[model samples]
Target: MTAPAPETEPTPPPGRRERKKQATREALLDAAFRLFASKGYEATTVEEIAEAVDVSTRTFFRYFASKEDVALTSQEEQFYAVLDAFRRRPPEESALTAMRHAGTLLIEALEVDGLADERMSRFDCLMRLTEESPALRAGSMERTRRKNDEMTRAIAERMGADPERDLRPRMFAAMASTAFMVAADAYRMGVCGFGSFSEAVDAAFEVLEKGFAEY
Candidate 1:
C-alpha cells in the first residue's frame, strides 16, 4: 500500500459546481456504456445516450466530443493519470522503477479510494465493450499510440536523455503501457490467483525488471 507523504500536497476537493458537473458527466458516461452494451456500439447514438440520462443531445456534446470519445473516456483518463504519476516520481528513481511505482500507485488508489467500486465496474463494462467492438479497440489503440509519445518524452526528460537519440525511454513507455493493460486484464480475469489490480501490476513490472528470468 502506497501511503501519501505528509509533505505531498493534497489535491483540493472540487467545488460544488464542479462536483455537479462531474456527476452529470459520469451519469452520461454510464448511460452511454449501458446503451452501447445493449444496442451495440455501432448502433448506439449520442441522442439515445442523452435520452437515457434525461439530457439533450447538445448537452452530451458538452461533456464528450463524440460517441467515440465517451466510449474511450475512462481509458484516456487512466493513461493521463499514469503520465502524471510518472512525472511526479522522485528524480533518483530509475525510469522503470518510477514507471512501475507510478502505474501501480494509481491502480492501488483506484482500488482503495471511495470511487473504487464504481470506477472498476465502469471499467468492466468498457472492457467488454472494447472486446465486442473492433472500432473501439482501434480507436483505443490510436489514442494509446498518440499518448505514448507524451509518456516517452516525460521519461526522457526524467533521465535527462535525448529522446531523439536514445530509445530506452520509448521502450519503457511502450512496456509500461502494455504492462498496465495486461495487469488490469489479469486482475479482472483472476485466473492467476492475484489478489488485487496493484498486485498484478507489480508482478508485471517485476518480470520486466528481471528480464523475464523467471518466465
Candidate 2:
C-alpha cells in the first residue's frame, strides 16, 4: 500500500495576514519614535530603524514614505481620533460644543490606550525633531494644515452648512485645533504647572466658549 500523504500546512487567512501587517506597522512606528527620542530624528537613519525592528529598509519605506512620516505618526493618530470623535458627537450639539467634547474624548481615549505618558513623550520628541530639522518642521506644519482643512470639512458636514460659503465651520475648525495645540504647548513648556494636560485642554475650550472677552 502506498504511504499516506503527509498533511500540509494551510495558508493563513487574509484577515490574519492583514493583522500581522498592521502589527508590523505599529511596531515600526514604536521603534521609530524610541530611536528618534534617544538618538534625535536627524541623527537617526531609516536603516537603523529597520534594523531595530528586524525588518529590511525596504519594509520601512513600504510603511512610511520617509523618516519625517514616521516621526509624525503620533500627531496623525491623534488628528484622526479627534476627527472621528467630532464626527460622532450629538447632531444637535453646536460646533464649539462638539469640538470641546471631542477634545476631551480624544484625551480620554489616549489615556485608555495605556500609553498616555508614552504618547506625550513621543510628542515631545516630535517637537524636538521639528525644531532640529527644517524639512520635518515644514512637513509637520503642512500636514497640520491639511488636517485642519479636513476638520473644517467635517465641521461643515456636521452643521449641514456650505464648506465654501459658510465661514463659521472653517473658523471653528482652525480655532479649535489652535486652542488644543496651545494647551499642549503650555503643558509641554511647564507653563501649565500643577495641572494635567487634559485640564489645560479643558481650560482652552472653556476660554473659547466664553468668547475670550475676559482675557
Candidate 3:
C-alpha cells in the first residue's frame, strides 16, 4: 500500500492576514501611547512598550520606528480620515465648506467616549509633548507639510484645476492649514476658553467661510 500523503497547513486568506497585522500594529500603538502618557514620551523606552504589549522589542520596531511614531498614529489616522471625508462631500460644496465640515467631524469623533478611548487620550499627551520637544515639533511639521501637499492635490481635483499650474488649490490648502493650526494652538494654549477642540475648529471655520469680512 502507498504511504498516506502528509497533511499540509493551509494558508490564511490575504484579508485575514492583513487584519491580523493591523490588529498587531494597533496593539503596539495602544501600548506605546499608554506608556508615553503615564511615564512621559522621552522616558518611555521601546522595550517597555513592547513588554506592555507582551511582544518583543523587535515586534514593536516592526510596527513603528520609535515612541514618536506610535504616538502620532492617532493624528495620522485623523488626517487621512479628514481627507476621506472631504472626498465624500457633495461635489457642489465649495472647498472651504467641505474642509470645514471634514475638520468638524474629525474633532467631534475625538470627543466620543468609546470611539476615542485611551488611544486618543494618549494622543492629547503626545500633542502636549510636541509643544515642549523640538524634535517632536520638527517631525510634526514635516508631516503637516506632506498633508498640505496632499490636500492641495485633492482640492485641485474638486476644482478641476491643475495643482501645478493653478495656484488656487495650493492657496486654499495653505489657508485651511493655517486656520486649523490657529485653532489647535488656541486649544493647546488654553487661552480661548473653548470647551472643546471641536468648538475652536468650528469658530475658525466660520471665520473662513465668512472670508474674514467681519474682521
TM values, all candidates: 0.90, 0.83, 0.75
Clashes per model (N, Cα, C within 3 A):
0, 0, 0
- Model 2: per-residue Cα lDDT over 42-100, one tens digit each: 88999999999999999999999888888887789888987887787777777788778
lDDT (Cα, tens digit) per residue for candidate 1, span 176-214? 888878887887788589988788888998888888666
List lDDT for all candidates, in order.
Answer: 0.83, 0.82, 0.78
What RMSD does each model have against the real structure? 2.1, 11.8, 11.9
What is the descending lDDT order? 1, 2, 3
**By lDDT, is 2 or 3 better?**
2
| TM-score, ranked from best to worst | 1, 2, 3
Query: Model 2, poorest ten-residue lDDT window?
Result: 1-10
Q: List the residue pairs that clash in candidate 3.
A: none
Angstrom error of the Cα, residue 153, model 3: value is 0.7
Report lDDT (Cα) of residue 70, candidate 2: 88
Q: Give me the runs in candidate 2 sitting further than 4 Å from their true place.
A: 1-23, 192-195
Q: In candidate 1, how many Å is residue 149 off?
A: 1.0
